[model samples]
Target: MASTSRLLFASSFSHPSLSITTGSDATRDLWLKNRKVPKEHCSKISMQHNWKHSYKCIDGGSTRDKSRGKFYINATSSQSHESQPQSFWKSTKDIMHTLQKFVMSYYLITMLMSIISSSLLAVENLSDISPKFFVGLLKFIIPITFMYFYAVGINQVTDLEIDKINKPYRPLASGKISYKTGVIFTISCSVMSFGLAWMTRSKPLLWCLILYFAAITCYSINLPLLRWKKSTILTLISNIPSMLLTSNVAPFLHMKTYVLKKTTIFPRPIVFTIAVMSFYYLVIMLLKDIPDIEGDKAAGLQTLSVRLGPKRVFWLCVSLLEMAYGIAVIMGATSPFLWSKFFTVLAHSIMAFVFYYRANSVDPEIKDVSQSFYMFIFQMMT
Candidate 1:
């Protein structure tokens, strides 16, 4: 019966006028008209696809599919495959972009350099530090990155209105991300930072991380009792601790994990570096508000630039930075090492000039100029 059915179906397919329909009913009708097999013994056939000269069928309860015109065979099991790795990499790229937006990628270098320089200065012996420093640096990066992302993410969430004027194109302000998602991401980052820090089991690191986080909390949150960012002086004072810890102290603590004793919290070089950075940070923070004067005024936040005017603020920033560079240059020139003086004087003199040139050329109302100089500050630090 099967042989007779196959021959009849083959003869019908050869006929030009007979159109084969790709449907179960069509298959059943054709099978019933040509074959005399009992319904119980004759398995149902499904026509999957149709072409000009071909069709494919899979019989019920059968593990194989047969094609007539262009016979194709599958020797492997009928498991489906997909491009999982490609999808995974695409998701990874998206995550990295979001992370960069959250943490401000340009500022990451400043943090990294802080760790490197602090580690170098923390140890009395320079020759002793080697590739191990970098290995340790890599490990320290995970927690620090999470902490920074959390801090900035919270700031973005709280300062959305101000950012709309100052940085409308930002991910949160521009509506690229929803506020709920931003809050969740920030909270996750906070948890990850603390979890990673706890895993390290270093007393100094845990202590420093706690202090940094406390300062960040006060700087960003709008709690009625602790709106630290509202006042310029309070903002500067609050941010100073986190800045010093992240840049100069965190690296030192990480590097000296095994050798840390009851020494002073701030080393000599760290104190000087933090002083310079505090002044630099204060200038940039003020300049940051210059472009947002309209928004700040609308929000009733009394930033320095709003009170002083942009031109005056611009010059103030330039002058303060110049003084910092001048002091650094003097320190280098007066150092016992002649090479230190030569390099410091040359590098700082060039930086001072560049700062002047750039600041002079800047249009005070333009936020992009402020951002450009902000990046330039890190470039010089590097």
Candidate 2:
């Protein structure tokens, strides 16, 4: 009877159809050793050696089975790494969209064009283009880009609440980026602008960038004593210098020494350019507030549009731009070059007409018309 019971127990231990319980470390170790599982599966199998967590070695193949408190990784899934490029491109597009909202790429393009035009015009001869001219032009690009980024970033950081009302879709106001990130980016850009300007070894250019930075800061920052944007006159006074520097004076200063080998004496074209831009920008500033009248009023900012109403502000902006075009026509007609007269007169006249008609057709509630007109002004400058 004892021998018969012993044989039955031994057979039960070797039975293939029976399910083995891995309740202890000894059983788990015994099962692993008896199966002689591959090294890859051994590591994952060994991790589940706990009283509650159970694992099974599926009999069909070398694949390990995952259960409660246990894990398994498929080698075939490594092919998912192939999707990395697509993931990378999607991330890149998202970043670019964010940057567009933060920095206003359309405005940046126009600013770049204005800077390049002013630089080229400062040269007395078109034939003066050379390697050095290109090199100097290239050098100006970094400082310009950094300064504008700093300006926009800092403004967005400071005006988060205002932007929630005025421009809710913006990266900062929409919570796409944190306020701390915006401040850090702004500070870095500002520092880089100055550092790159210093690298150019031009004290005058550096001073111009400094002044521009100051103007932007004064216009955007709500300092107790220096909140220039709260008043129309102060806003215009603060922003004009920045516009002039980015559009005319700084570029002229940069190129004059390189292309002309001489100091600029306020050439006629440059003078006219600054005058037209200054007046146009003043109009733009006023018109810009027209779309934000509600926010400005609620915030007690006292902008021109809050005082004058959108329709009046719209017409006023159109009239001012027309006046600028008229001046351009006069300057064009008197120019020594026939091509200059023809192009300037024709372009300005068309733009003036476009502004008048477009501004009249726009709905007061939406900013499309006013903002488009603003872009149009910069387009002409370019």
Candidate 3:
């Protein structure tokens, strides 16, 4: 009976007009009419047809049809498999976009500055620049990088609306990354930062991370009385000390205590670098707002640019930076080492002139112009 049923089923495909129906009754009728099969066998064929139909539904693929004599593949399964790489690529792109817009340059600049400062101040001999030195530097930088991301991520999360106005290309602002994802990313970064800092068992590094975390929290978090970024005075207070610590003092102390196994001492270069960075960060805090005046105004954020107008604030920042450069020149000239004096004086002089030229070229009335200048300032920092 089974052999006969199989022969009948194969022969059914010979009739091009024969339609396969999912209904058991239709299938049984067709089989009986076409194959002249016995009544008892027809029930088995009908049951087979129903089972095939159920299997097709469950498998998400089409069953063989008599008319076409072809099996249909599972389209949904194939499409999902094909899209896995594309979905992964898109997610990766979104993450890169977020980093570039939010913290990529800042992270790179911070790491570069920290490494340079620490190496200059801590490394005294050729033996100091070894594999272990680099490994220790990596350990120090990893936690700091995580904290930097945390700080920027929290700011982006809190300033979503403002960023939509000022930085729409950002992941959170453009809706490429959900707010929940941003919050999760920030939390993860903070956790990883603290965890790594704890693992190092370095008090200076741990305290620096704590201070940075607190500073960013106060600057960005929109609690009832927080969000220091909305006020100029509070913004300066929160930013300057954090920048000074992170840029100069923290790295020096971490290297001296953690890597070099030496007592902490601020050399003339370290102190001078701190002073220069303090002034530079002050200018940065004010200059950064110049391009975002519109967004700040819309958000009711009383930034220097929003309070004093962009043109006035622009000149103010440039003048402050110029004065800082002048101070650097004087300090460099007075340095006891000839090479130090020559390098610092010449570099600052050249940079000051270049900064003046760039500042003169920027028109505060143009948004893109001001924004480009803001980025240029970051380049200068690097």
Better of 2 and 3 by lDDT: 3
Flag the better candidate by lDDT, 1 or 3: 3
Model 1: per-residue lDDT, tens digit, 230-335?
Answer: 7888877878667777777777777766333325455556766877787777776777777678888887887788788888888888889899999888877887
Mark the 10 consecutive residues where model 1 has the least summed lDDT.
Answer: 11-20
Question: What TM-score, over all chains together, does every model reach?
Answer: 0.73, 0.77, 0.77
Show where candidate 2 strays beyond 4 Å.
Answer: 1-76, 83-89, 258-260
Report the C-alpha lDDT of model 3 over 1-382, residue by residue, as the tens digit: 7645454554344322223345566655764565455664343332224544431111123333444435444355567789999999998986787656765655467556755665558777888778877777777788988898898899899999999999898878988778998899889999999999899887878998999899999999999889999999999999899877776787777777788888767788877887888878888888888888888899999887887889998999899999999999999999999999999999999999999999999998689998788888878877
Ranking by lDDT: 3, 2, 1
lDDT of 2 at 22: 42
**What pairs collide in candidate 3?**
none
Each model's lDDT comes to 0.71, 0.74, 0.77
Clashes in model 2: which pairs?
none
**Residue 294 local lDDT, model 2:** 69
lDDT by residue for model 2 (47-101), tens = 2233646565432112244353222333333445767788999999998888777
